[model samples]
Target: MQTLETMRSLGLLTPEQYLEITAYVMVNSTPEQILAMPPHLWQAVMQADALLFPGGPAEPVH
Candidate 1:
């Protein structure tokens, strides 16, 4: 399995995608679970994210 860093470096994913996916992933999965997820799954999550939360995930109240 490719690490996210490796994928990013290989130009398989952009910085924005990384941030969006990583943010959603951090909120949804465990660290161990993320390792098992493929890039396609990340994209799927990103797509559904917009539909599931039209306004985007709520901003953290600082």
Candidate 2:
């Protein structure tokens, strides 16, 4: 999994852009891995996850 910092350093994206992508990924990705992400990415992931999983937030309930 590529981190936002890593993507930024690689010039693949800005921090904000990466955050947005991360959020998108969270919404589509399975719950186990999304839940495993580090704290820094949690908010972005959750936002995306919510958007993607509009029926409900992705789980392990966080």
Candidate 3:
């Protein structure tokens, strides 16, 4: 399943609100930054085990 689809399946994201939020975050942040965020912001990154990919697994950001 796609990341977006999985998010929906897990009830983290919904069809109605996905586009707006996706647009906002996509425009304002890099996948690297989002990948580094704590779960309180978006648990899906951690839950999806993507913390270690295309960005530091858990490296401190300077």
Candidate 4:
């Protein structure tokens, strides 16, 4: 899997959420799609989902 710089660095996603993102994309996307995706795009995707950071972004609680 492509290890794109994830949103974890931004302190938005918990470690668990970061792993889930990696796994989610791995299961849902082609290797080419994953590799071609920019870090900002990944950030945008993660931020848009409440599931990724539940409790409405109060803190990084997996």
**lDDT values for all models:** 0.63, 0.60, 0.54, 0.59
Clashing residue pair totals per candidate (backbone < 3 A): 0, 1, 0, 0
Per-candidate Cα RMSD to the true structure, in Å, reads 12.3, 10.2, 7.6, 11.3
Which candidate tops lDDT?
A: 1
TM-scores, one per candidate: 0.44, 0.36, 0.33, 0.39
Cα lDDT tens digits, model 3, 1-62, are 26655665556665644454465567658778656554544564444346224463767879
Per-residue lDDT of 1-62 in model 4, one digit per residue for the tens?
32223346655566666676677676668878766666765664556455445676576569
Q: lDDT for model 2, please.
A: 0.60
Candidate 1: deviation at residue 40, Å?
Answer: 8.5
Ranked by TM-score from best down, the candidates are 1, 4, 2, 3
Question: How do the residues 1-58 of candidate 2 rate in per-residue lDDT, one tens digit apiece?
Answer: 4545554566545568676666756575877866666665665545544554468843
- How far residue 10's Cα lies from its native spot in candidate 3, in Å, is 5.1
Candidate 2 has which clashing residue pairs, if any? Answer: 27-49
Off by over 4 Å in 3: 9-12, 31-62
Q: For model 3, where is the 10-residue window of minimal lDDT?
A: 45-54
lDDT of 1 at 28: 63
Give the C-alpha lDDT of model 4. Answer: 0.59
